[model samples]
Target: MTGSPALSSRIAELEAELAELRAEQAREADGAMLKVLLDDIEKRHAVERRLHRAEEWLHLAEEAGRVSAYTFDFATGTLDWSPSTLALYGFPLDEQPTLGRWLAAIHPADRPAVQAIADHALQHHGDVDHRFRIVGPGGWRWIEDRGRIVRNEDGSAARLVGINIDVTELVELERRASLDGERLRLALAAGRNACWDWDLVTNQVTWDQQLGVLAGVADFGGDFDSFWALVHDEDKPRVRAALDRALATGSDYRVEFRMVREDGSIRWTFTQAKVVQDADGKPVRLVGIDSDITETKLAHLALNESRLFLVSVLGASPDCIKVIEPDGTISFMNSNGQLLMDIADFEAIRGKRWVDLWPAEAAPLLEHALSEAVAGRRSRFDAACPTAAGTPKWWDVSVAPITAEDGTVERILSISRDVTDRKDADDQLQLLNAELHHRIKNTLATVQALARATLRSHSDPAQFEAAFSSRLESLGKTYGLLRSGPQAATLSELVEAELGPFGGRSDALAIGGPEVLLSSNAAVSVGMILHELTTNASKYGALASPGGKLAVDWTIEDGNVALSWREHCGDPVAPAAPASDGGFGSKLIDRLTRQLDGKVTRVWSDDGLSLTCRFRQSAD
Candidate 1:
């Protein structure tokens, strides 16, 4: 095909023309294919335009829903804020906010954080999620922003797409809740209260450490239902009502109930709660407090019961019961107690002295009784009691001790019964018993003499028996002397009785001691022991010699009663007289000493035998 010149020229020219035509045809075909491709591309771009428009509408819708979008071109140092973004910045929708102006709207405190977050996002080409405060036309608003770095093909951050939401209301609500939480924390710390948080959506509960202790549940192991189960059956309904009311109307809730502790103990508690809601007014959380009041309630109830019992017992008593302080104040009086003195004015009697209410004759009796009672005696015989109305009354007064915390006798509780009606009968009975005892003792003495006389006349046994009869007569005489009254005889009377056998010369035996009166027990033991000792001495020691003389002396030493009997002007006592077995008289002396819880000592001296006995000076 590449041949000759003429032929070649003609052919070449023709070929060149053909080549041109082929090239043109090829160009046309290529142009046609390109046109078709361009048409298809334009159709696709038109569809994408429609989608892009729909996406823009979606973004606008989101912005209308309290949201705004923003973009920052860091390379160009430019910012583009949507209408919502402008409005969020408190600027008109048409207003254009520079990057610096937009940043200025952020709270100064949060600006650094926002910049740091942006810088990090730009540097790492990473997503950023942040919240900051901004001052706007309305007030300080909280803006929660989220954005992603738009990276260029070279992996460098080119732009930032972010959305800012006005979370001012939510943040304010959170702040209020935080304040409430702080207040509740203070209250709990002061009162040792417990707290609870309930999540309605999750149906779960969180309990403070103390609430777990109150409910007796493990702090971390209980659910809301589990905690509710611990409420006492009687209080569950009320607690439930409180919760329901709070949830229904978002009102404050308050209820008091009992809870069953883990250890099966019951506790009274007061609870209060408030409901928290979302922006849509849907309940989100319940915050409450619980306080234990069991101990206080129980103590109050017990005190009430005790007071009632005390009042009842004191009131119902037939005898007059009075509480009188050491200072002579009548702190309390039963009905009978007030009536006893004809004192209707309780106020006047309150601070008045009890002694001031006594009649002249009864004053002595009252003083004596009070003195005896103050000496730790439980009771005393009051011959007479003076009344506030000038009446003379007799009472068998008994004073019981009421000690205070400091170990002092704080009050004297007196119980007195009116014995006026029975006084005559009691006196007559006492006289009759004393007469009967005296008569019987005299008759026994006479009978003993008669029996001795009969035995002696019948056999000579009377001679030995007469000695015993004489001693019995002496004892009868002593008894008659003491039965004269409530007072027991003195030591002088006792010694005189025992020495009567010695006749007129009994003066040879001297006796001395305190003038104090002897109690019945002391009088009896002393009389028996002295009588036996005198009889034994007459038979074997001092009185056995004509020149013998005895001296008896008694005294009180410390709290003990001491008595000594010594013999003089007689044969010196023999130490080796062969410690004979004790006779009945010696044994009697020992027995009497034991009965008196006393000590007896016998000293054998060159002069004679000296005997001393000591006994505790008590009424026993």
Candidate 2:
């Protein structure tokens, strides 16, 4: 080829320089290899580029795989790590790897196991595939290390080269998978269930063989018609409608229905189904489970019936009946019980502590009752409490424990009967009985006094009997007035009891007095005094003969009763002394008058005997 002038001149200059280089190389050594030196330079540059590319690929592989290569040199007792390996331990890239840092980075709990693996590998020259943990500035990470130990001829570990791969996510996934498996196992073991799959578009149903066992049949048909035939006739249409609605709304389907078995016995089942939808939210399939729930259903029904029966019994009771929880809270109260308690809304007081519901005055009693019940015993108390409407009541409350099958106290029962009326009646009865007893005792003491006086006055048996019997009769008449439902008797009533047998005003006997009520003591004493006078008058006074006149008058003055008695005997009167007996009658009069806390005075005149007495009447 012909060269241009500039090209020719440049080639001539290169040849001239090449001739001088050849002469200089001949003076040196190996002048014949100088002609291939340019080709060798080209090859050397290509090798350098390939080495740079390879290093870039290695660094990328380490970073992308979350991996780092490690090397441990036994001879130097030093460890070497790439930049990624140092970063994995939370160390700066400029930090050099050291044996101490490497060993310290291992988790304390995992260190011993790792050491054992290393020791075994050193002695046996074995391959290692271990998983462990390491902690750094970055919390902790799980690492799966796989490596082979290079050994010397004597089987001592010369070096260990391995890759550390982060496996935290894989470990977590495995743990979750294990837990899910355990849950599935527990669900299957909890009950007898028959699983099914339904293809909505194909109208096909696939059921497990357990369905036949539930239906009391030897074999079950796999088609939808066979499964539908097992459903009770009354429930089929409802079941179909429910399924349709569930699919329409893409919701879960739950139903409880009856299944007639082959033996004509009824069984109950609960079914729950889930719909599988496509990407566009259209239903594609249904997966369901049919669980045998006959036992549970029957028990629930029986429990409900028992509860109803108990409710009826409590409703029929006239007393307040309450059920308390173990925590001493009111749990249930019958409708009638709420009415008796005057609680318009039971919810207002529900869950309130039973002790808190009582008045402070009755809290101690209520607390004691509750403690007794909690200890599995019975206690009773009678206390006064007001209702919710503030009506006062006396309640006879009986608290008993309700026990569970395990013999533990499960609840408390409180039955309160209103006893306000009964309590009042009992108090009144006690008071009447006490008063009657007291009066009877006093009467006996008075009788002793009458008998003693009669004995001293009349030594003869016949005379003594006549006087004592008459005195006893007068005392009896006095009590008759006192016993008439009042605590005291009228003064007039006491006087008439003793004087009625003698005569009225028609027979020349006069009696007048303002109405006055006297206590039992005053009545007894006054009656005795009047009787003594009457006995004397009838035997020796005006009543002893015809044409004799007798009169008695009384008045209340300054809280005291003043009485006057007079008589006209048709003959002139003698001295003011007893004419019917010795001084015994006068002495008896003196003694009874002293008992009245007053005095009796007598004045004799040509007319008759004038006797008057003054004393205070006791109200007690």
Candidate 3:
């Protein structure tokens, strides 16, 4: 920590030099020559102080920002390397190298640029800011050298001060980045481009090779003016104004402007620049790259056109197409859907729940389908539903789940078709078939009865044919009327249909019964049985006289049917004849009663005959 007394005395002598400088400035104001000399000494002293302070700063900076320092004294014709700088090159301070020795230590490939930069600074008295390579203990390393010439009192070059930063890693990263940028620029420049830079400190401009080409310059020619000259007249002012605002606000730079190409054709170019600021918070530089996004713009236009086409198709589709969520929330509905719901305003129905639009009974089915769809199942179902105005309709619906990339169900695609008309037609056909079967069965029975009756009575074939056809036709009409009831025909309707041919007025037939619904089979069987009984009665029972009246009563008791028929007046009462040896009418009634799984009881009365039949009663 201690220095020789002579070294300390040398420091005191340097302090005296500073004192002399102060004294000279104060005492020799009127002596122009003295004043000049004093100014010169003071300048030299300041340089000395700066050199000392710069040395201290270099050490501090080396530790602070991991950089070192060096200088070349042209007056002494020697290189003064700081201890840290020498240490960086693997040289100890006592073994300090000469200027030529240090230069020789630089890698051969880098020495040329390193020497040239220093030479240029000495020759022009200007500053040198450049990068060079130095071979050290750590192998070849990058060094950033920035120096300015210090002039002597006699206006001669005296010294140079510079800082060297170990920028090996920074340089490598920069090299890779530069390569990447070059690759990107070349790839993007198959069309055209304009690259620019704005120095916030000096407001100076820089351009790249593509800028000249985009501006129609035949060659780069290393000129900035060429780029400015080709800026379109309409875009020049705007670009200038934008740059001004960017500088003032330190905001990101972005602009789209037209630049004339080499062939004098104009193409739009877009540029986006980013500013780098100094420690003082002032933007020091901006680097920007320009590219043509024309194809991207054109694609957006085509996409819009395609979307319009799809929208038109959706609006016109015949099926009641609706876009709905898995939970049955409706998002969109086509024209057919609007019509099906009787909604003239589709907007009013948007976002409504699909189940709410359907009959309440259908809600459970809808919920089940939605749950299955969410579970990733495809489901389909058919339902009879009432619409908004309570008009019943049938719909066949299909649903499938659509999922996102992560396999989460995102939407359910549902399609439904109204099949009410088809269903109605099918029901009508079934009814017709059933009715046809009933008619054929009754007609066959009638023919059978007529054949047997004609044989037993020795009637002629023509008479049998006339009687059988007439009776069967009457049965056919009766069956038709009974089949068309509100729900199921009443016992009275059944009797009237079968005996209407007998001139039985409404008042001539009496009916009493609890309400019951008859299945089609039961209806047909009951009608035919009544027809047979009435046909025989006209010839033998109460209905045979104008004063005679028929009474019918029925009740559903303990799930079984009890029915009674009373025939009075037309014929005199006779004792019950045991089972007739073969009356065609008797046989037919017996067969129908058996077909219904019932029993028939006949009572001979003075007034008429009463027939009662009991059977199971079933609902349709």
Best by lDDT: 2
For candidate 1, the 10 contiguous residues with the lowest summed lDDT are 1-10
Which tens-of-lDDT digit does each residue in 1-620 have in candidate 3?
A: 33323335556887787687677668766677666767777776787666567556657787777576666767666676666677778888767568678788788998888888766776777888888788888799887877777788888877787777888999999999999998878776775666777665665677776766555566654434555666789899988888788878889888877777767777667888887888987888988888765566568668999988977887676567777786678887777766775677877777888778877887888888888989999888888877666778899888778899999998877777889988989976885576466546545644464445444444687876666566557666776865635455656677656665443245667767777666666776677677666655554455545566888788787767777888767546343332244554565566667777888777765676678788656433
Better of 1 and 3 by TM-score: 3
Preferred candidate (TM-score higher): 2 or 3: 2
In model 2, which range of ten residues has the least summed lDDT? Answer: 1-10
Q: How close is candidate 2 to the true structure, as a TM-score?
A: 0.46
For model 1, residues 1-620, the per-residue Cα lDDT tens digits are: 12112223443454465455556665686777665655655665576566557547756665566788777777876677766677878888767678577778889999998888877876666788988999988888899898877778988778887888888888889999999988887778567689888888898888887776666677555467787778899888888888788889989888888888778889888888888999999999988888887888789889999999999888888788888777766788897777876878788878777777655766676676566555545655555775778776777777766776875676778788888768868866885576456446434544453344335334556664665566557656855654434557677888877665453345567777787467777777777677656644554456544566888888987767888988774564344221135644565577668777898888765566688888866545
- What C-alpha root-mean-square deviation, in Å, does candidate 3 show against the real structure? 12.4
**Residue pairs that clash (backbone atoms under 3 angstroms), model 2:** none
Greater-lDDT candidate between 2 and 3? 2
Q: lDDT of model 1 at residue 606?
A: 56
Question: RMSD to the native, candidate 1?
Answer: 23.1
Q: TM-scores of the models, in the given order? A: 0.39, 0.46, 0.45
- Tell me the lDDT of candidate 2: 0.76
lDDT of 2 at 10: 49
Better of 1 and 2 by lDDT: 2
